[model samples]
Target chain A: MILKRVFLNRLSGTWMLITLVIILSLPLVIGIALYLKASPIFESQSLYQLIVSTDWSPCNGNFGFWPFIFSSLYVTVLSFLFAAPICLFAAIYLTQFSSKRLIQLMHPVIDILAGIPSVIYGMWGIIIIVPFVSDVLAPLINIKSSGYSILAGGIVLAVMCIPYMLNMLIETFNTVPIGLKEASLSLGATSWESVKHVVIKKSYPGIISSFGLGIAKAFGETLAVMMVVGNMVQLSFNPFEAGYPLPALIANNYGEMLSIPMYDSALMFAAFILLVVVLVINLVFRYFIHKTQSQ
Target chain B: MNKQKEIEELFFKFLSGFATYSLIAILGFIIIIIFVKGFGALSLDMIIKTPKGGYYYGGEGGVLNAIVGSLYIAFGATFIAILIGIPAALYINVHLVRYKRIQNTIRYFLDALWGIPSIVYGAFGFTLMLFLGMNASLLAGIITVAFLITPIIIRTFDEVLSTIPKGLHEASLALGSTRTEMAFKVMFKQGFSGFITAVLLAFGRGIGDAASILFTAGYTDLIPTHLDEPAATLPLAIFFQLSSPIPEVRERAYAAAAILTIIILIISLTARGFSKKYSKSNLK
Candidate 1:
């Protein structure tokens, strides 16, 4: 009986290891498959041309990704600009200043905020943000266009990513030793002084990674941004101008991709780029988290 | 100099307070908007009947198909996720506990996977479907969602398992139990509540997701009777309804969002309740 049990453990353990290996290899395998499938059809065009050219005309075989790439960075950067200060302040408030009761109350709220669906965010963006941008904000700024613009996308993306950024920043702030903060206070530093001097300095690495995580989320976000980004394939920096990001382009167009020549290849390349960039950002973010954790 | 320092301190303090309250205000406003905008448009028929015509131009019928479809896809995906997630988590905690390097590497990959956006997973699934000569169906959506939520489940549950004292494991081993036995019989008790929380969190995530299912789960008015049949979901339903040029259809989108929010609220509340209950009866 004991021998049988021991053998079962070995068998199951081997199976578990095999499963682990397969799960780890899935991304690489999919990436290679996507690359192979993409490379053949785009063989006529240089990869450089495809990446650098601003044109996205599938009929003309101009599969340049410059517009989409720039648009993604533009909107993601705009979101960071809008979201970073509030999230940092909120984290500082919760970690350094809030009472225990307030902390207990606020933690669940943050978690619930994190749990809300991205698509509901799209609904909110459509109902509230779109018209506010087009009718009110844009007119105030003397810009004229549809409600769905890069600015709208950036605003909605900021809201969508705030909870995640707050969670990370708060966790980072909580990691600061109580002794350090108390010592700063004992040396004639006010509460804000300690936060500004010791807390912020100690947690800068985590805060940066939190920002990276937020940027990655906005960069890769599709549905909500798709609802608001207006999906105009263009290379523009004007916040009011309509634009398309890579994920939004794929989301909106992939259904009809079979009919368009070289469309699939172009789209595949975009996905690959997004996947790789997101993976790299997350790896760096994890490095920060791991470093802090080990300390 | 003293006045300037005091003013600076007050300014920073006010800024932090304003930021926190702004978050609270935003949450309040979103909830109010959904309920108020959705109240008049929310009809019992929408919950009980499928759209009679197409889901365009403010058409008739309810989101019965979508509600049913959403539940099916989420539950199906959760079932698959839990099966693989729990065992994989068990493997890491029990089998690989001695090999810190291998465990960290595995965790590193999972975190990376978690960070990969749902849309990328959708694109990857779409590509894989094309390669397999299979069309979009409920099965495809479920599989995609399962892949999407696995990392979440494993990571959350892994944290739970990690909370168990090291002495408990040592004690179990000293009592002539194998690692597998110890995992299932000893550590599992302490982690079961957390396991529930992990699955619920993944379920909430799976149901609310629209991107991963956009292409894979082809829309249908009927509740899916087979795995191959296309199915409607609440998020996609809201997306399509809100896209309509008609004002009435747009209002229905708010109603759908309200429903989605309520379900998630219930899940989170129930999770808190579960934690309270389990902690009271905790072994440690």
Candidate 2:
């Protein structure tokens, strides 16, 4: 029995170690595979060439990613434009003026929004947002209704991102000391003045980190954006124009990529680019969270 | 100046308050649209039978294949995730608790893991499958999802485990118990409900996500009978239907979304209920 106990304990320890190894090494395996599969194309093309060129046609062996990259940036920026103020002020209101009851009520709603599948968000966008934009929104902006455009993608992304942004910002806002708010109020600063000058100022770094996280999320979204983003290869400043971002580019073409020469490598290259950008953002977000937590 | 400050305060106050409260309108609007449009699309066959005769092209049949596939992948992934996640959570909190920097470093990796996009996982899984010479299959989907949720499970479970009073751990150690024993018997007991909550949370995330499994799982017309075969999932179902040129099939996308939403709602509510019950009993 004693020997059995000893063996069991040792087995348990081994199991934990094995789990650790598996989790830690999965990323390495993925990274290496991405590098290997993408290197042939990488060797042929310079980073500068890839970033500057605008064409991405497989028939011509051209895989310029500038359009995809700019589309991603445009939509991400637009999503933040829609999401930031609403999320910021709402988070401020939530932490400052909201009652406990209201907070409790909002928790499940936000969780529900967060819990809803991304594709469902896509579904919603297709049914409601897409039509509204095509019929009403685009016409308002004097563009023909394409029903799928950067504006549609951006709006859907904002809804999807709001839950995450609010979660992060609310936590940051909550950490602002009550004493500071009280001190501001005692000095005759109004609630808005105190919140604007004190709470938001104090939590600016955290807010920026949260936005970084949101950008990572916005950049990586695939199914929802793919549905509404009207996956075309184009570089234009018009939000009404249909465009392809990196995730959409990868998703739309990865299946038939092997059918075309170098297409597999090109799509793999896209995935590699996305992974690097997102990882950097995530690392920045982690640093910000750690800094705030330490403070 | 005083009057201006007062006016500005009230204006900003109402604006911020409007921003805060507008979430209700937005959420309600989204859910209402799903229901109003999706209601016509739901039918008896949707829940019970597999798609028949090119349903993606607007034919007869249901999403039974996708439903089962999603369950198989999510449950399978969660099982693997729990096996690794619980052990990892306990290890970091127990074995490496004294080394705060190491723990934080480990946690930061996990955080980054969670933050990586589902599509990246899909792409990564696609690559991994190619390396193994494996076709897209239920097994591949499960493995990818296992990677997807490991960080979520670990982090949520860690939050619960970390909140356990230090006295409990010290007490267990004073009794000459091994840290492993303390983890399972004492800390596990204290964090039992949280484990449940964390599992459900991960499962909800797993089932809801389509991007990670999109390439790894591969769509099929029939329910997955074996882990070696490709399996369909609800999110992919919605995607296929929405992409179909047929308006009827397109409408079916909303029905699929409605069904997916209901499943997630049930999971969230159940998780909350169990956690609430445990919290009440945990008042001591």
Candidate 3:
């Protein structure tokens, strides 16, 4: 009986081992397949020509990614510029200065906000934000059209990114030792002084990490941008009018493809580039988090 | 000295009070805006009926289809992810007898996968699905979301398995139980709650995802009768409706967003509740 039981155990163990092997090997297999498929197509296309091409007329053979790339960076940078200061202040207010009860209340609220779908954010941008931008902020920003310009998209993106930034900053600030802040306060420093001299200094790495994550999150976003970005597929420095990002371009056009290898290859390269960019940003953030935690 | 100290204490208390209230005000404004903008659009028909083509409002268009698609895709993603992720996690945890270096390398890849942006996953899945010629299929969306959910479940299961005390496994083995039975019956039983939480976490993430599904889950108005067809999901529905120029569609968008928000809220809160309950029950 014991021998039979042992045999059954071994059988199950073997089954599980094989399952594990398959699971662990899937990504590697998928990666190899992707690289093999991408390499042959990319070998013929000059990277410089592809990057500089202004025309995205896939139907007519133009597949320039420069406009889309520039638009992505432009809107992402603008949104980060708008979001960083407000989020920094909010994080400081929550962590260094807010009372425990307030922190408890605010944290869940922000969590819920963070949980809200990006799709809703797009709706909010159109119904509440676009008009405000078009009628009000557009004139101030000196853009003629407030309806679908960079300014509108940037503001909406900033709002979408704020919760992410706030969450990261709050977590980072909480990691700062309370005793350090108390020590600064005990030394006749004001609350703000303590935050500046002790808390901020200690949490700077995390704060920077949050900034990088915020930028990456904004840059990689698709649906929210798709709704507000107007899918113009053109390159423009102005905030208003239509523009496209790589992810948005793929999201809007993936369904329209006629199974062309060039189109597929373009998308693969774009995905790879976006993946690399996001990984680089996240690695920077991870390094900061590690460095700060070690200290 | 006492008076000066008291004055300083009073000043600090006031400052803390002021700062705390302001933080509350900031978070409060965000919730208030969502509720104010979204609440009025809620209706019974909106919750139950399907949108009648192009006419987004007042035509008894219901969120029933989207609700089902969200659940279907999320569950599909969770199923595939668990099937793959749990074994990998278990192997990494228990069965890594040789090539520890290779195992660790794979483990690091999973960690990196966890941090990869959802949009990139969307793009990758979009391109891959297109290449596979399964354009706009729910299965493609499911696979995409599965890719997104993999690292999360693996991490959760791996951590849960590692945290289970070794004594349980040892005792099972002493009783003549095989390594597989000991791992599955004893360790898995101990880790069941955490495992459930991991699944719930994956489900919650799958449901919350928008970018990853946008391309693969190609938006369709009609109800999905099969897995091969393009189906509308709550996120995609919300996106299209909100972006619609029609006021009725906009209203439906609000209702949809509100519904989605509520569902996600429930899932997230439930997942958190399960973790707490399981941990507490285990302690008792």
Maximum-lDDT candidate: 2
Sort all candidates by DockQ, best to worst.
2, 1, 3
Q: Of the candidates numbered 2 and 3, which has the greater lDDT value?
A: 2
TM-score of structure candidate 1? 0.97
lDDT of 1: 0.85
List TM-scores for all candidates, in order.
0.97, 0.97, 0.83
* Model 3 per-residue lDDT tens digits across residues B38-103: 788888878777777646644656888888888889999999988877766766666663565665
**CAPRI-style quality class for the chain A–B interface of candidate 2:** medium
Each predicted complex: what DockQ? 0.66, 0.74, 0.38
> Ten consecutive residues with minimal summed lDDT in candidate 2 chain B?
B275-284
Q: How many backbone clashes does every candidate have?
A: 1, 0, 7
lDDT of 3 by residue, A1-295 (tens): 8788788767766766765666556455545544554554466567787788887777665678898999889889999998887778777777766668877677556656566667767777776677877788778868677476666678788877887888888889888889999999899877776877888898888888899989988888877777777778777776777788877876676655546657766766676667777767876677667555655
Those runs of model 3 whose alpha carbons end farther than 4 Å from true positions after fitting are: A1-44, A52-55, A177-191, A259-261, A287-295, B1-39, B53-60, B90-108, B130-135, B156-193, B219-221
**Ranking 1 against 3 by TM-score, winner:** 1
Q: Which stretches of candidate 1 lie above 4 Å from their native place? A: none
Instruction: Please report the candidate that would top DockQ against the real structure.
Output: 2
Write out the backbone clash pairs for model 3.
Answer: A149-A239, A149-A240, A149-A241, A150-A239, A150-A240, A151-A239, B49-B62
Q: Please say which candidate is ahead in TM-score: 2 or 3.
A: 2
Worst 10 residues of 1 chain A by lDDT: A15-24
